[model samples]
Target: MNAGIPAAARELTDRLGPDAVATSGPLYDRTRRVWNGAVTNRPALVVHARGTADVQAAVRAARDHGLPLSVRGGGHDWLGRGVRDGALVIDLAGMRRVEVDAQAAVATVDGGATAADLIGAASPHGLSAVTGTVGAVGVAGLTLGGGYGLLNGRFGLALDNLLAADVVLADGRAVTADADHEAELFWAIRGGGGNFGVVTSMRHRLHRADPILAGTIFYPLPQAAAVLDRLNEVLSAAPDELTVAIAMLTGPGGAPGLGLLPAWSGDPAPGEAHIDRLRRLGSPAFAKVGPTTYSDLLHANDEQGETIGHHVACRTRSVPHLTPDTVSALVKAAATFTSPLSRVLCGQFHGAAARVPVESTAFGLRRNHIMATIISWWPPGDAEPHQTWADAVSEALARDALPGGYPNGLSPDDTTQIADAYGPNATRLRAAKTRYDPSNTFTATPLP
Candidate 1:
């Protein structure tokens, strides 16, 4: 143990109230370990902020003591940036709150709320948020870093629907940033991530996304190439209401196969028509397609089955088209899956998501393109083989894929290529950083 941990913990508790402070104890270890079982970084203290005032106090303490501050919002990020050695963690899990304004078609979510929380709150109103494949992911992290979701084709990325946010800067001031106030920060957080400040709450526009036609269509390994060709054709010509994530994995039966998971947000009749066309693409070994709620679609891929104690890493590349060469390369990569839970996931950024301008937000890529990710997960003591396979897949795809990468799907090796992540927004994002966080207060992740 550190010689000064007790004194530091005592001073934090005295200033911030014991109820909201946690020191070196079982409780502290438990809190730090809850998020990512793979993250072993132990912070000196954890400030469990119950509200905005608590966040402000924690920020002041970090500034006063010159200690690094880690903002733990939902703490579901794959990178495990929530905890760091010798830092102070501002834990926001106690702040889960979501409110829906049906009349205005908007939903307000606290920084700590997960996508599942927001979906549950908004679904009763017959409205929905543009959330990702997993419902349990933190809304703040997903939205801020370009949320690709089932409804992305219909509405846009989650950040595109964000209207405003209440943020606490490095200097300890709580302020509102939106289109009308603190405009630069608003633009920055849309995709620049948690570099500007610690967000307290966020307001997002909602959409009518009920009665969706969503499910999976599985095909034999021999049909992968043909099915991908058909997938490329259908998604390119399909209406904005349709989006699909096609996965290649070793199924429960231990055989290589392809699964086309589609989501249609338009009227049921047309949605079924599109699904029918997709169903006819290849001779399927199995299929499950029918009516389902958008919320259910969001939770379909929640990684609850994978024990958190396993090492999880990911690599991604965006390509202009699912060319026959690209599809073959990806299928070949999936053959190297190290665990039953590991596989390749492919999707596209088109329709409403593609229409948004690159300059509109800090997200780098804004064109219609297909993306493939190698999700490599392995047990506690065997990350080498899985990570090596993922790296090989990444290098293989980079040859035919575009230059840029998706922030949420990038691995440690890929994120270091920051130019590919932020693109043209790099200059402006750094300028805004110079003005708002010159000292680089938020250093947990890759920032411009």
Candidate 2:
């Protein structure tokens, strides 16, 4: 037995079993891996928690040992808060369990379950969970930071669909948070990062959205300005069922180009009308707007073979409008950026997400807008160029954007923007942090 393993972990060795406690070798390396390959964290120990009881044990052990702690769900976060350099990581990947109550239209998902797991379970019953663009993203991390996805325009964000959550706090107390029970903690968890506790399970309200018309349209760089204007107009008046996401990239043969994905989650008749209009907005190099599943659309975002395991940095902003200046800036940035692996996406935010009152929940930014992400990726040793390029593009596009970026998009260095991320609900989040975690045991990110 390695004495390097903390004594606190030794206390629960029998209860959690040897396989659950990893300190070295391949298993330890596996537990340490996260979606972003750039995150290099070697924790003192990794606890592969199988249930809430195991989570409580890990929390108590960390607290008793006076060790800093972090939680790992899907480990897909850009900040890589899931597994830190020296903290003990509570690995929930083993606890992935998805239960669907079709009659009630709710999915009770374990924290470790990825977006793919939840969607695969719910789709069989013709119901769908509003998930992030990536299928590998952790449900807990995404929900806690206010999830955005293809269905967001129609059904609202993943946090907006969240009905309840089972949380294990720093003190080993497990509680179910919802509208009535532990309401403050519930509010805090909606947009607050995992500062208060570790969520064991989340009950999300599901929508009856399954197969829909969704695909991408590609056009030359010169046409992006008019196409973006038409898109702004179409989305400004379009119903909740139709959501459009646009990406600017260096297309085939290294030409500046644009790709758009219009996802409509309603009857084919009205949706076809909208898709036709969206297709006609620009002269395209190619177009493939057609019928498919939301799950398929989720994977389409990753079609370029660009994902975790690649050195990548992303910066995002929420813009009120695609003002001419913003459009020109985006075009110029795309034209100037040299990496083929990098991409810039502009997705519409409206319908239910926009109607939710700003103060009703912890997801503070309620206005209708464009959520833009500047993604940069490269090989291991050559990260500076990509990161610097992405930041420059983001800086250009952010002139007319809101002050705060999405919590999920914030990098590890962006602790100062926590208030902006929570907006009007920052005070409540701080108080809830005090009430639930006075000692601030979950130090992965800035408190409140």
Candidate 3:
């Protein structure tokens, strides 16, 4: 234990026992390593909450002690917000319990469930919800941040499918927030992020999507510009049943390439035309677009997990259409990537995402055809070029945008980007923060 441990943390351990409260030792390092040894975090203590009651105790203790509480679910936060230096981390990784009611078409998921757990549970019933690309990302943070994924264009954001949530307020009482219950808090949680409170459980709208037709298609690097141009054209006229994301990366041997991850919710045959058109643009290096289980596709990107070592910065923005200029910018940027692990990604934002009026949810950037993310990866070391590279890429890409942040895509560290993400809704989020957490006790992001 640390020398200055708070009395509240001690009290929590007294009530829940030692296993519930992680004081010092291996688990603490494990929590720190979640940020990949890059960001520095020395929390006074870490509370591993196993249930709603445990979460309640931790919250009350933190509030009573005036200690900042960081809610950690899957521990995949891009900004490393899950564990802060000298704060109490309410680790929710142990609370992963997924209850799927196929008849009701809803899934009651604990705050700790990862995308992998949710997909695995729902896929058997031929049901799924919109989540992030990474299978290990916390469902709570990802959904509240406007989740984007293969199903995004088809089903809109993960929050768009949110039916209800059980959030522990600043006052230490657990309340269910939904359309008809705690309606205002429900709206705030939809896209406002974790600024208001800690969400312990959620009710998500699930769709019947099993054995989905999904996989990635790789093309020669020379055809990336052409591929993006056509992608914009096809997605503009495409239906909500089809969603796709384009990735530009320097391959294993430094061979630059482009990958298209296409997912079709309906019949897989209809997507044949689009896939074929893409195939004709350039010779394929590898292509696996066909009928597959959702679990298989969910695990496809697991290989990248090993590459996350330290500080990683990502910049995102939306463009009306993939113009020649944008395509050329992406092509040129691919050359500057020093890390083979780095990538420039293009995710489609159409279908149900656009059909919803922009004002319907707190998530912004609705009227664009593409969402571009530039990521820089490296081990912990000097912060010079790492910071420069991330800034340059994000700056060059963040030009076009709609108001309000996309929630799922923006990192907590990007305050300016948060403004871009929230746009008009930014003001309301601040006001909600004031009313709900007037003392700023629950502050995390979407800063007031």
Candidate 4:
């Protein structure tokens, strides 16, 4: 072991006690790396915080040591902002706590809780919140970055349901940020990533629907443009209760396919009518749609799957309308998905996501349906070609964008590119940051 690590370990162990810190062997290394390799970092220490008290200690220690602080939730960060060289990464993975209030129709989740965790907690109450499609993605980062999900159109974003947040600021003081308390911080937390403070807990509003009719419908790649064209027409008139995301990709067996992840938050009868628009698109390679709980919906794709090499890079845009030329560009990109290792995705992002006013929070671009995210996935060695392919496609679509980026989906290279995503909201965010986190010590993933 390095002499430096042992010293740091001893110092931390003395302050936080043995159970709260780890610097021996693989433990530190495992927590240092995130989902994205292109932006990997190595931290000097990792504090496996068990609760809010541990989080406060980690923050104070980082400040005292003059170390860069990286607050990690699920560690599913695509930009690898969860860890940094010579920094102190406060790992919240051990603080997962989900509390559901059936009568109040709300769920208070610890920062470490994943989307799957919240979904499971809300299932027994017959309620759900808008969460990321990937089950392992953390609720804190996702909600902070303006979470987009199957229920987004109907119930609003994960942040829209965010009632309050309990956080530990950069100075190590613990406080709550919400509508009535620290109002500006509350606005920032809704869509702003973890720039102001380290959130230890969050309380989210929940929807009252149960056994949501949800699942994906996969079509052959040939129908990519046609289905998107049809989706635009139907979604424009469809009620907010129905939310669907479209993806053009190569499925499990190296086959190019177009898929739709649909979730209905309304009655099953009307859901059938709305779903008919998709069922009639064309003969899908496979179709699976049914009434399922939020827990089932969250785990539907891979309920039994383990955390593996799930790497994805995405580009987002809020288009005015899907033009024929735009559709052509999308089809051209989809055609490039000839390789089984990579693919393009065109997900719908509107309704409740857009229903909120742009000035309501730090998040911008709330009024567009097609949030085209070109994602490519592969094993470690093949990331170069896969990401290159995804980047090329994203660049092509940026021409039709309305500006503003999803904080959670950002790549490390896109750190400076976030301004474009914020559009008019950029000025306000900077001013807020200047007032709150002036020194920018908390600059983490998708650095604003």
TM-score of each: 0.95, 0.95, 0.94, 0.93
Displacement of the residue 48 alpha carbon in candidate 3, Å: 0.7
lDDT of 4 by residue, 293-409 (tens): 877766755453332555655555555666676676677776776345455545566676777898999887777657666666655565566667777777777777556556666
Report, for all candidates in order, the number of backbone clashes.
Answer: 0, 0, 9, 3
| Cα lDDT tens digits for candidate 1, 317-413 | 8888888778887778766677776788887678999899999999888888877877877767767888888888887777778876877666455
* lDDT tens digits by residue: candidate 2, 316-428: 88888888878887888778775777788777889988999988777778998888888776667778778888878877876787867787777756655555877888888
Q: Which residue pairs show collisions in model 4?
A: 354-366, 404-421, 405-421
Error of 4 at 272 (Å): 0.5
Q: lDDT of all predictions, in order shown? A: 0.82, 0.82, 0.76, 0.75
TM-score of 3: 0.94
User: What local lDDT does model 1 show for residue 359?
Assistant: 97
- Model 3 Cα lDDT, one tens digit per residue, 165-228: 9998887889998888888888888778887888899999998776677777887678777777
Which 10-residue window in model 3 sums to the lowest lDDT?
400-409
Candidate 4 lDDT (Cα, whole model)? 0.75
The TM-score, computed over Cα atoms with residue i paired to residue i, of candidate 2 is 0.95
Q: What root-mean-square deviation over C-alphas does model 4 reach?
A: 2.5
Which stretches of model 4 miss by more than 4 angstroms? 1-9, 37-40, 303-307, 310-312, 338-341
Off by over 4 Å in 2: 1-5, 252-254, 302-306, 444-448
